[model samples]
Target chain A: MSVLTLEDVNSYYGNSHILFDLDLEVEQNEVVALLGRNGAGKTTTLRTITGTVPRREGRIEFRGEDIADDSVDKISNRGVKLVPEERRIFPTLTVTENMQVARDMSSGNPRDIQEMYDVFPVLDELRENRGRNLSGGEQQMLSVARALIQDPDLLLLDEPTEGLAPVIVDDLYDVLSEVVAEDVTVVITEQNVDFALELSERAYIIEKGANAWGGTVDELNEREDLLDEYLSVGGAEAD
Target chain B: MVSLGLVFDQLITGLTIGARLFLIAVGLSLIFGVLDVLNFAHGVLYMIGAYAALWAIGAVSIPFIGLLGIGFWPGLVVAILAAGLVGVLIEAGFIRRVYDREPLDQLLLTFAFVLMLTDVVKTTFGSGSNVVDPPGLLAGSLTLTSSLSLPNYRAFVILMSIVVLAAIFVVLQTTNVGRLVRATSSDRDMAALLGVNVPRLYTVVFFVGAALAGLGGALAVPTQSITPALGNQVIINAFVIAVIGGLGSFAGAFVGAYLVGISIAVGSLIVAGAGQLIPFIAMIVVLLLKPEGLFGGAEA
Candidate 1:
């Protein structure tokens, strides 16, 4: 069974229709990437699953329960966390406070944020620093680490590596792999198709708000023609 | 040149006024910081508290202190509840619908409510001014200098303000609920996913903010006469304080309040006309330079 499922979800912003009957799912211990170009509703898909944007007509089920109408706070307390686009870390708060804020959300004991810091050793060095002071890569690491401390059942990350150095990309991949090993399910939306594929075991590609293709990482790797046609990356020979 | 005693008198008066501004401005900062709404009708909420206290004390028979205690205390509590209820009604009925609307539309709605509330008080209370005398225990004057005397009520207001700040500090810095409140203000949607009851929190925050305004009005009634427009003069000052302190910075509110308080006091002594506008001038400079108040970081 899927850990997180969105069935026929439709989301609207005022009169504008952004998400149209989109269906997606993430299974236990799986890293699934939602890939699309700008304005393709990738962010909205993540928001809808987490109940940030109102779903006009759809059902969102997480971990065997219907949670479409549940409050975002309620949905999150059930161990679902979202690291929003733009690395929405409280820039005013120190790394420790930001983590504490996330930890304080649920009623129980918080997950060990140290393990996250251990994975992103740079963040451990800058724990006393404000989130804004950190480089783009460090802020993204803080965002991911803060979410992990919640011991989330399903994690939603949007554009985790939109603007980062090449070296930071390797660090993010390491963290993503470690997260899945802890039995956490992840659904990440990414504009960087290469970066997403490096970390995600499964992939869903969309164009203009509709699901264009859905398959495993190996299938996407083999189908270079499909990637070149939709994502404009490269065909089979480009590698 | 004034003597040492004269300076002390002004210092005491400054503390009283500073504390009052702090209580009122802190709420304004919190409301604005979290939702980014200006709450133009905040003054009306204050007026409601003053009028509520007047009615409660007049209708119910009690001793002066009891009237002072139960009157302003209970009346302030009720006013806060009423203001919060009104806030929820406004939010659910109007603000909620305009959550995504342009800022101007929301401002216009709140401005309209301000006018409506002012009219409501004018019709109910008439144009007459009402004054609730301080309880005899808190009525006497403190003879700080041979000639200068300070009212006990003013001192009480100052003490209560400090107490209120201390309590809020405990909650915001140490408690779980306080942490949740801070987190939500930082990133609301993420806070929700972390299991914060945001709508309920919004309602609570609105009510608390309204209550603080109401409490300000109730406290003011003993020292000053109450009228429909009594809150109007104070609200702008409170806004200036909130802006100078940086909308959501709790400690910033105190800094802004005392800075403005001392400036206004000292300004009047130097140049009465310009002194009154010192806070505004300071605000102008602040916005021009920082735009975000002293303590506000990126959220500013």
Candidate 2:
């Protein structure tokens, strides 16, 4: 069953048009990767689904219910949550307090705080520390953990591995791998094509604000020409 | 050299003055901290609070309230409610329209409320200055020593400030709503995306902020001559406090209020008219030293 579907969605940031005729779908409990270079509306697509964009046209369906016009919070209440690119942690709030915000805001039954701590044990150690005091890797973990606490049916991750040391990235991969085992569906937008493909079963390539190509992970890996053309991911030989 | 007794007297006076300023300035700081709207009409809300208290005192004759031994207590409640209601209307009706617009638009919108509300107050309460007598229970002075005594009402005001400060701290520190407020203040978009109702939260904040201003005005009723221009006059001091403490830093506002209060009181002792100039001078010095304010970080 499809958990989320966007048909012919065109989004705008004030006067500048971002997403153009973007069509996408995510099946229930599936990890889908949205791949593109910078400024290709990958983040904007996630934002539009979450109703963060200023203006968006076309249909956005969550669980077969049209939610194209729902407000951002309302969309979130309906079980779609977005972990934005910048990590956007509340600097003044303690790590536990940050998680408490998500728990308090969730209309659905939120995950247990201890469960989140179990997944990201570093968060437990720094639970009393303010978000600003955390390292970059810690902030990202907190951001992702905060979304998970909401117990969202469909989670949107924007550039989850944007900037981090290789060690931190490996840790995040382990955490996400654990999350994928749960009952939630994920739609992730990424510039790191290799990392995204490793986690996602299917991939959709977006270029210049529209869908360029999409297929199973095996099919996408076979098309080196498509990766080089759209994602600027050099063919296997170039590496 | 100033005598210790004289210095003590001036410090008490300064604290009383700072207490009143905190009532007004903290609201301005909270509104800015959360809503990101510098409400110029905050003073108008304070004025409304004073006028509301004055009217409530005259209109209601609750014998039980008088029996409770605090005649003007009900008046304070009225002031907070009236000002809070007006704040809700201002936020929901006017300020909401300008949130997505530029900061100048918000400033102009609030300034327009200042003008409009001031005129409304003038028409209703008249342009004449009004004064409220301190409640009978607190009408006398408390004698400490042969050389040291304090006005009972001023002591009450200081106690009230402390109570308000404690209450706010408890609410912000312990409550879920408080956590949401801190989260929203830090990153509004993220808070909203996390399923927090941002617009409703904005309204709640404005109501609290406006209510605090009204409480300040109502509290000042027994202390100062209430005039049509009272809001305009106090708002300047409130702004100075907010700026000195840093725009959204709560601790900054508290320390800044006391500093301004002490400066004004002590400066008056040193020079005849220096009280009026000291706050500005202090602001300039603080800005020169630490541009963001004492407790102001990048987030605040």
Docking quality (DockQ) for each candidate: 0.55, 0.75
Q: Output per-candidate TM-scores for chain A, rounded to 2 decimals.
A: 0.92, 0.97
Candidate 1 residue lDDT tens string, A1-239: 88988788888876778887788878888999898777888998887777787655687898889988877777788888888888888776788888888777745557776776777788889988987698889899988888888877788889988888988988788878777777778888876788788778999887777788899999999998777777777534322
Per-candidate TM-score against the hidden true structure: 0.84, 0.94
lDDT of 1 by residue, B1-300 (tens): 766666666676666667767767877777887677778777777777777777665632223333333555566566666666776676666766665678898888988888888887787667588877876668788886587788888888887777777887787767777767777877776677667787778777777777777777677778668888866877898889877878777788888888887777666666657666889999998888888787766342
lDDT (Cα atoms) of all candidates against the true structure: 0.77, 0.88
TM-score of chain B of each: 0.86, 0.92
A113 Cα displacement, candidate 1 (Å): 3.4
The deviation in Å at residue A151 for candidate 2 is: 1.0
The residue-by-residue lDDT of candidate 2 on B41-117, one tens digit each, is 99899999988887776732223343122347898998999999999999999999999899999999999999999
